[model samples]
Target: MTPPELDRKSALFLDLDGTLLEIAATPEQVVVPPGLPSLLAHLHHQLEGAVAIVTGRPLAQTDELLRPFSASAAGEHGVSLRYADGTREELPAGIAVPSAWREELEAAVQRWPGVLVEPKPHGFAVHYRLAPEYGNEVWRLVRQLVPPEHPWFHLVPAREAVEIGLRSASKGHAVERLMAHAPFHGRRPIFIGDDFTDEAGMRKARELGGIGLRVAEVFGGDPANVRAWLMEGAQRLDGRSASSIPTGVTP
Candidate 1:
């Protein structure tokens, strides 16, 4: 067992869905666990601004979900950055997503049953949870619409669906970029997440001599694995605390 230590140079990386918030059928319907903002704020202050939420969701969505606390966020894998300093940065200027492609992808998904296509300011996504069988078909059409010239756009495969976003971003890249900045930089990276996309950040965090806590869900497969991982991670965090672990659950 790894002995817990109060390392001042520790940067905590967390994933929103299945980490800070529970995953839902639609991205828009997710519930923000009560007191999560406050708990994150406490963690942020305790870690001296070494806390960050690295997720596949868009940066703006992550910000909106973690209202009040708005801890540093890396969205769309890591292509976008929103720092504590109140600045948001996107990838290179040349990689702007063309509107035509967005509409094309949206139209393509509309024709497929159980496929929910959403438009992002930068890219697009095709949700196939309702029609899991169409997963590969959705990817085929999406791939046809995307050209290799767009260096910032790529497809990210999740549990039940595939998301197309800026290619330049990822959880691992976000962690690297965040650590290069103040407070987050120069700290040991402790990443917790429950998704295939999060593996990059986890691997990177371990390479940096920090811990990668995998949260597992109680049911389901991989997502469940993430929920379980988080439960243990929370316990680990609780055990090291001088005080009791603050429950986000309201009595």
Candidate 2:
């Protein structure tokens, strides 16, 4: 299906790593292009506050990467959410990981040379991106450390990482919550992402009468192309003719 036009009527939800920005060896090492902040600001204006970054990164990290302009966002796979008006919400305190589990994860990471443990308010993640050879090891450790029948937490295998978080909160839930509010309530939802974790948000977008554009072979599997498409969309929204916009992939 053709994606909804990038206009005021559509609500745009974008993933961060590997979608808006190229994936780096380490999450902290990803580079934000010079003009991306400005471009995103323009798109947010054009969409009338319908633009948001739906990402796995924490809100603080997302803000650090896309500084000078803050859009609505859902972070930590939807464990936290900040609306357009700046109101924030997060998974309840009841869902937090136990201290014992946190210690176990930290100890496990110490055993792996390049593995990193990122602890969130609600859960934790073991990233093996830097040590690809230890991916299976990381997964195995997580499985053994975290009980299979844990009531509140569940394991989410994402790109080069395994995240254990609240079972209830998810990208799909995030999208649903955003769509229930003003500006986004009536608008069609468009989700752009490039990972298995993003599939939830993509499916939610389609359920809301919009399309999900996967960043893969179709768009050259490059985040640069996604950026170009966004820039062109912003330009078109600024009253430029569609014909003046570069063609290839349409967002």
Candidate 3:
């Protein structure tokens, strides 16, 4: 089926790594190709400031890369949110994982070479991308640290990493919350992502009367395709004539 075209009423929610940017050995290693920020800025204007980056990384990290061209954003899988007006909100108080757990997790993952423990204000992640062979071992260790039955925390496994965080946070809830506010409200939501963590946003988008586009085998499973798609859509939104739109390779 042909994908839906973005229009005036569309609100776009996008994932970062693997969707907008190519997945890297480590989260910090991901590259933001030239023109991406400008493209996002164009779409944000086209959509009337309804564009957002819903990512697993922190808003600070997202800002670090997308500075001077910010839009709405939900970071740490919805642990926090920032609107176009620059207002910020976070999961209610008392939802953070205990400091002791963070300390323990940090010390435990050191045994495995190439394994990195990234600490967030609300949770922590164990990345084994550099040491894919240790994926199972990393999961096993994380499971022990944050058992499945834990009341306040749960595990989110994605790519080659496992994140343990507050049970109240998720990409779906983030989308729902943003849609209830200005700009996003009354718009059909379109979410695009490329990983398991992105599925929640996808479902929420469809439920809210839009669609989810996946960057998998069909789209070459790469960020270039996503950029190309956005470029075409941006051109269309800009009212560029069909003949003037670049007929580049499909993603």
Order of candidates by lDDT, top first? Answer: 3, 2, 1
Where is the poorest 10-residue window by lDDT in model 3? Answer: 242-251
Q: Pick the candidate with the highest lDDT.
A: 3
Compared to the true structure, candidate 2 yields what TM-score?
Answer: 0.91
RMSD of each: 3.9, 3.5, 2.9
Task: Name the lDDT value of residue 168 in candidate 2.
Answer: 81
- Better-scoring candidate (TM-score), 1 or 2: 2
Q: Candidate 2's residue-wise lDDT over 1-251, tens digit each? A: 33345877889999999998999877778999877877787778778889999998989989989898798999988989999889999865456788897788788778788998887777778889888898988888778767779777789988898898888888889999999997699998989998887889999999999878888843577898888888777776877764554443233
Lowest-lDDT window of 10 residues in candidate 1?
Answer: 217-226
Each model's lDDT:
0.71, 0.84, 0.84
- Model 2 per-residue lDDT at 189: 95
Candidate achieving the largest TM-score:
3
TM-score on alpha carbons, each prediction: 0.81, 0.91, 0.92
Ranking of predictions according to TM-score: 3, 2, 1
Clashes of each: 20, 0, 1
